[model samples]
Target: MEKLQAAQLKKVLKPIHLWAIAVGLVISGEYFGWNFGWAVSGTIGFLIATLVITLMYITFIFSYTELTTSIPHAGGAFAYAYRAMGPFGGLIAGYATLVDFLFATPAIGFALGSYLHFLYPQIAVIPAALVFNVAFILLNISGVKESATFSVFITLLAVGELLLFMGIVGPHFKLDNFMTSPMPFGWAGVFAALPFAVWFYLAIEGVAMVAEEVKDPKRNIPRGYISSLATLIFLALGVMILTGGITDWRKLSAIDYPLPEAISIVLGKSSALTQIFASIGLFGLIASFHGTILAGSRQVYAMARSGYLPGKLAQVNTRFKTPHWALVFGGLISFAALFTGTTSQIIILSVLGAIVMYMMSMISLFILRVKEPRMERPFTAPFYPVFPAIALLISSICLVAIVYYNVQISLIFFAGLAIVTLIFVILGKHKVQILIHTD
Candidate 1:
C-alpha cells in the first residue's frame, strides 16, 4: 500500500575487520561439532569428506566474491539471485541464508554454554546459552563497528589458542591413533559425514552479507574472503589431525567441546593447564556466536527491507544505526533452537541450508555471466565458469549425500522451506513489488 524505504547500514568495516568477521563466524567449527563426523566416518573418511568440502569452499568463495563485489549489497546471495533469476530465486537464497546463520548461532551458543559448564560444574547449559544469545544481541544492536571490533579481538585470541593447541598436541600425535577405525562404515561413511565436514567452514561465506558495511567492498571483500579461507583451511586440517591423533576419536566424537577434551588428554584432566585452556578456548565459540548473530541480523534486515518478511524487521535503530528488531528476533529463535536440539543436530541443519544456498549462488554466477556480460565486475573470479561449475557440482553432491544419509533432518529442512514458500506465495508476492520501487 505504501512505499518502504530500505534502511541503510553503517559502513565501518575495513578489509581486516571483514576478514575477522568472516573467520570469526566459522572458527568455532575448529573447536567442536566436526568430531561428530568421526562417529559416522572415522578420521580418514571424514578427512576425505572435509577435503572435498574444502575444495567446494575455495571455489565457492572465489566465485561468490565476484557477486559480492559486483553487487555490493547486504543481501549477499539473495541479492545475486534476485538480479540473476528473479523473485523465486531470491526467496530461496534469502530463506536458506537465514536458516544457515540462525541455526549456526545457536549451535555456537550451546558450545559456549558447554564450555562454561565444563569450567563451573554448577552452571547449566540452557541458562548459559540464553545469556550468550541475549548478550551478543545487545552488543550487536549497540553499533556495527563495536561488534566488529569485538569480533576481531576475540578472533585473534581464538587463532592463538588454536596454535597453542597444535603445539601441545603435535608431539603426541600418533599416526596409529589417527588411522584407527579410519573408515569404520566404509565408503558410505564418507557420504554420511558430509554434513559434519561442511561444518568446518559453514558460515565463512557470510562475509558477503556485510558487503554494505564494508569500505571499498570490491577490493576488501575479495581480500577478506580469500585470506579467511586460507586461514581456515590450515586451521581445520591441523585441528583435525592433532586432536584425532591425540586420543580415541570416539571420546570426542559426540561432544560439543571436542578441543578441550582433546587438550585434557594431553595436559591431564586435573591439570590447571587443561582448565586454563578450556576456559580460554571459549573465545573461539564466542567469536563465531557473536559474528553469526551479526550476519543473521543483516540477512533478516535485508529480506524484510526488500519485502520478503515483515517490514518492521528492517527498521534500524535511530541512535545506533543497527537492526535492533532483527537482532532480537534472531536471538529469540536461536534460544528456542538451543533448548530443542543438540549441537550436532543444529549443525547438520545449518549445513543443509548452507549447501542449498551455495548451489543457488553458483547457479546465479553462471546465469549472470551469460546474461549480463557487460556488467562491471571489479573483481572477477579466477578461471570463470570452471570454479563456479566445480562449486555447483560439489554442492549438489553434498546436498544429495546429506538427504540420503540424514533423512529425518532433510525432511524437517524441506518442510520448513515448504512453509516459508507457502507464506511467500500468499503474502510475499505483493510485497516483492516494494523491492522494485525501492531499488
Candidate 2:
C-alpha cells in the first residue's frame, strides 16, 4: 500500500462513477447467464438460490467496504489479505481476482458476439467477440476517466433496458407459469443452481479493485457499493421473475438471449421493437466486458507493483496513466479463452475464483480486526462479526457446491492456481519485497 511509482492512475472517479463501474461489472449477469439456472433447477429452485446468494452479497459488500475504505488499494481483496494473512494470502487473492475478471471478459465478449449475430446473422460469433474484446482493451488503455465515462453511459442504457424489459414483460405474469415444475430435481436442483445464482451479482466486488482511484474512498466507496447492490437486487429479481412468466422457463433457459426471446414471445418475433430491444441488449454485455477489462488490469498492475508479477506490467502509460501492459496481457488471456472454453465453463471458472476470494476477504477482515486494532476504519461493517461471518459461511458453502457440481472445471482452475503458487514460491519474491500496510 505504499505510494505507487512516478506514474499512477488518476483519482477522478466519484460515487456516481463507482456505481457505474460496480453495476456495469455485473450487469451482464442480468442479461444472460442467470437463466441457465432454470435449465438445472427450474424457475422456483433458481429463485431460491438467487435469494440465498443475494443475501451473501448483501452481507459481503457491507463488510467488504470496510476493507476498501480502510486500505483503499488498487489490489482489492489481495491488499486486505496481504495485510492480514501475509504474502501467501496475497498471492491467493491476486490469482483468484485475475481469474475472476480475465475469464469474465471473454464470457461477456462471447455474449456480445452471440448478441450481435442474433441481431445480424451475417456476422459470425467468435470473430465478433474477438473484435469487441480488442476494442475494449484499447479503450481501457486510453485512460480511466474515459473508461468510467463509458461505464456510466453504457450502464445507464443497460439498466434502462432491463427496466423496460421488466415493464413490458410484467403484464404476462402468471403464478402458474413460474410454478411450472418449479423444482425438476427437488433440492438437488437448488444446489446445482448456486453458480447461476452467484452470476446475478458476481463481479460487483470489482468496485473495490478501483478503490485507489475514487475521489473520496471513505464516503464514496460505501455509497457506490450499497447503492449498486440495491439496484442489482431489484433488477435481478424483477428480470428473473418477469421473464420466467413470459414463456416456458425451459425455452429461455438454454438460450444466450433470454430477455429478447421473452420479448419476442410476449410481443412477436417479427416486431420491430423486439429487434431494437435485442440490439440494445449489447449495451449490457459491453458494460461488463469493458468494466472487467478496466478493473482486472489494475490487479495485474498492483500485483506487479508489489513484485508478485513482472514489474513491466506495473508500468502506467506516461501519457494516459493507464496500465497499458496489464491491459494487453489480460486481453491476450481473454482472447485465448474466447477460443477455448464454452461460456458456462468460463463462468464456472470465474465464479470459483470469486467464491475463493470472497472467503479470503472475509477471513482478512476478521484477522485485521485483531491484528491492527486501531486502524482508521472510516466505515465500520455494521453488526461486526455477524455480517462477515455470514458472508464467509455462505461463500464457503457455495464454493463447495460449485466444486462438487463442476468437478472437471474446478480441477482445471485449482491446477492452474497450484502451478502459479509454485512459481511464486520458487521466485522467492515474497522474501525480497514485503507489502506494507497503510494502516
Candidate 3:
C-alpha cells in the first residue's frame, strides 16, 4: 500500500449554509415519502409514529451536537465512534452513515423524477432520475461553497413553497378527514410506519457530516443543528397534517408526489394552481437531492481518507478543491439503486441504517464522556445522560420495529453491512489508522 495524505476540505460554510444543507437534505420528505406511512398505519397511526420519531430526533440532535463540535470532522458519527471505540466501531458507524446518506440520495432522485413526470407527462421516470444524478454530481464536484450556495437558494424556495402549500390547503383541512381511518392496522401499523415517519427528518444528521467544511464549527455547528432540526420538525408536522386533512390520506399514500396530489384535491386535478404548485414543488426535491449529494460525497471522502474504503475515493480535484471521485462514485451507486427499489423500500432500508447510526452515535457520546472526560466540548447536550438515553432507547425501539415490520429490507440492510465488514477485514484492516489533523 502507498502512503496517503489527508485531503483537506475548504472551510467556507457559514451557519446559514450549514442550516440550509441540513434542511435541504431533508425538505423533500415533506413533499413525499412520509405519506407512505399512511398506507401502513393510516393517518393517525402514522402520526403516532411520527411523534415518537420526532422525540428521538430532538434528543438525538442535541446529543449529536456535542460530538460534532468537539470532533469537527467530516466523518460525522464515524469520527466520534472512532475516537471512542477504535477502528471496528468506526467502520460500523461509517458504513451505516454511508448506507443512510447513499440510499437517501437515490430516494430523493426518484422523487425528483416523480415531480418532473408530474409537470411534463412525456418524461420517463428513470431517465429523469438519471439526469438528476448526473447534473447534481457536477454541481457537487464544482466546489462546496458553490454547491452550498445553490442549496441555500433552493432551500429557501422550497420552504416558501411549503408555506404556500399550507396557505392554499389550510382552508380545506377538516378534522374528520384528518382522523379518517386513524388506526386501521392498529398497533402493528404504527410499528410498520416507523421507517416512513423517519423519512421526515432522516438526513438532518448529515449536517454533521459537513462539519469539516464549516467556518467556526464550534459556534456554528450547534446553531445549524438546532435551527435546522426546529425548522424540519415544524415543516414535517405541518405538511403531514395539512396534506392528510385536505383529502383522503389513501389518495396520496403510495404515490411519489403526495403534496401535488393533495393540492389537486382542493384546486382540481387540472387547475393552473395545481400545475404551478407541482412544478414549484420540484424545488423541494431538488434541494434535498442536491444537498444529500453534497453530504453523501463528504462521508465517502472522509471514510476513504481514514482507510475504511479504497483510497481513490478520497482524491480531491485540484481545481475545484472537492472530493470529485467520491461524488461520482456515490452518484453512480444512487443511480443503480434508482432501478432496484420502490421509494418505500429505499426509504425503509435507509431508515434502518439511520437508526443504527443513531444508536451507535449516542453510545459513542456516552462512552466518550466516561472515557475522555477532559475532551473539550464547546457545547454540552442539555440533561446529559437523559437526552442521549432517550435517543438511544427510542432508536433501539425504532430499529426493532423496522426490522420486524419490514423484514426483507432489514435483511438487505444487514447483508450490505456484512459485505462492508468483510471487505474491511480483508482490505482495510491493515490500512486503518487514527487520523489526526487540525483544520
Candidate 4:
C-alpha cells in the first residue's frame, strides 16, 4: 500500500455537516418502507431485531471512528485495512467497498423509482430509474455544498412527515397486533429478515468517509457516527413499533408501501396531509440517493490516492477540488444497474458487499490494535477487546444470515475477489515498497 503525492482534502465539510448528509440519505426510503418485514415478523420480534442491529451499529461506529481519525485518509474501510494489514488486505477491502457503493447506488435509484411511482402513478419505472441516475450524477458533479443543501431540506421534510404521521397514528394503536406472532418462522424468519435488516442498517459509515474534510475530525468523527446512528435507530424503532400498533400486521404485510398506507388509513387517503407525506417520501428518496453518490465517490478517490486503484481514479479537478473520475466511474456503474432486475435484488447484493467489508473492517481493527499499540488514535473504541469482538461476532452472524437467505452468488463473488486480491498482494509486495504517506 504505497501512498504517493496526493492532493490534500479540502476542509469543506464539518462533522455535523457530514452527519446531516448521512441522516438525509437514511431517512428517505428506508423509514417509509422498512415496516413491511415487521408486519410478518410481528412487533416484539421486530423490536428485538432492531435493538440488536442498532447496538451492533454503534459498536461498529466506534471501531471505524478510531480507524478514520488515526488515518484520516480517502479510503474509508479500504485504506484502514491496508495500513493495518498489507496491500492484499487493502485491495480486498477496497474492491469490496467499491462493489458495495456501486450496487448501492442502483438500489437507492430503484427506491427512487418506487417512490416516484407512488407520487406519479402513471410514470414508467424504467424512466424513473434513469431519471434518478442522471439527476444524482448532475447533483454530485455540481459540488458538495449544492448536494448537501438540497439533501438537508428533503431529509428534514421527510423526518418531519414521519414524526407527524407517527404521532397522529399512535392514538389509534392496538397492542395486540405487536404480540400476535412469536417469531412465527422462528430461526428461519430471523434469517429471512437478516438481509433487509442489515440493509436498513447500512450507510452509518458515511461520516467516516468525510473524515478528511471534517473540522476537528479527532473529536467530531466519533461523536457524529455514534450520535447520528443512535438518533437514526431511535427513529427506526419508533416508526416500526408505531406502525405495528396503529395498523393490522396482516394488512401491512400485504401492502407494498406500508408506512404510507398506515398514514393514509389514519388520516384518510384524500387528505392533503396524506399527500404531503407521500410527496416528501418520494423526493426525499431521490435526495438521499443523491447524497450517497457524494459519499461513495470520495471513497474511490481515497483508494486511488493510496495507489490501490488506477491512478486516473485519484485525479481531482483543479477548480472544484473534486474527484472527477471517481464520480464518473461510480455514476456509470449505477447507470448500468438501472437497467437490470428489481431494486430489491440490487439492495441484497449491496448489503452482501457491505457485510463482507464490515467483517474485514472488524478483522483490521484487531490487527491494528495488536500491531500498532503506540500509534496515535484521537478516538478509541470503548471497552477495547469487547466492543470489536462483539462487532465481529455480529458481522459473522449477519454473513451467515445473508448466505442463508440464498445470496450465494454475492458470497461467491466476494470469495473470488479475496483470491484475486491475495494474488495482487504477493505480486505487488516483492516488486514494490509498502509506502505509508503522511505530511
Candidate 3 matches the true fold with a TM-score of: 0.98
Q: State how far residue 120 of model 1 sits from its true place (Å).
A: 1.1
Give, for candidate 3, the lowest lDDT window spanning 10 residues: 430-439
lDDT of model 3 at residue 32? 90
lDDT of 1 by residue, 323-393 (tens): 99999889888978987998888998999999999999999999999999998899898998899999999
Worst 10 residues of 1 by lDDT: 430-439
Best by lDDT: 2
Candidate 2 local lDDT, 1-439, one digit each (tens): 3444536678899999999999999999999989888999999999999999999999999999999999999889998998899888999998999999989888888888888888889999999999997888889988899999999999999999999999898998988999999999899999889999999999999988788788878999999999999999999999999888877789988877888889999999899999999989999989999899988999898888888899999998988999899999999999899999988889889999999999999999999999999999999999999999999999999998998899999999999989998998898856664654342
Is candidate 3 or 4 superior in TM-score? 3
- Mind giving the per-residue lDDT tens digits that candidate 4 earns over 1-439? 4447777767777655766776765664355445545644555665666667776777887877788788776578887787777777777777777777777778777766666676678987777877777777777767666666676677677667667767887898888866677477665666566666665667667666667777777777776676667667767777777777775676776333666677788888888877777776665566567767877898888776766668898887786677878888888888887886566567667767777788888899899998998889888888888888888888888778767665565665668686767766665742554565433
User: What TM-score number comes out for model 2?
Assistant: 0.98
Model 3 lDDT tens row, 1-439: 3334776788999999988999999999899999889999999899899999999999999999999899998888988888888888898898899989999988988888988888898999889999989999999989999999999999999999999999999999999999998999999999889889999999999988788889999999998989999999999999998888987789888899988888888999899999999989999999999988888898999888877778899999989999999999998889889989988888888888899999999999999999999989999999999999999999999998988988899888889888878877787583556663436
lDDT of each: 0.90, 0.90, 0.90, 0.71
Ranking by TM-score: 2, 3, 1, 4
lDDT of candidate model 4 versus the reference: 0.71
The local lDDT score (0 to 100) that residue 345 gets in candidate 3 is 87
Clash statistics: count for each candidate: 0, 0, 0, 0
Off by over 4 Å in 3: 1-4, 428-431, 436-438
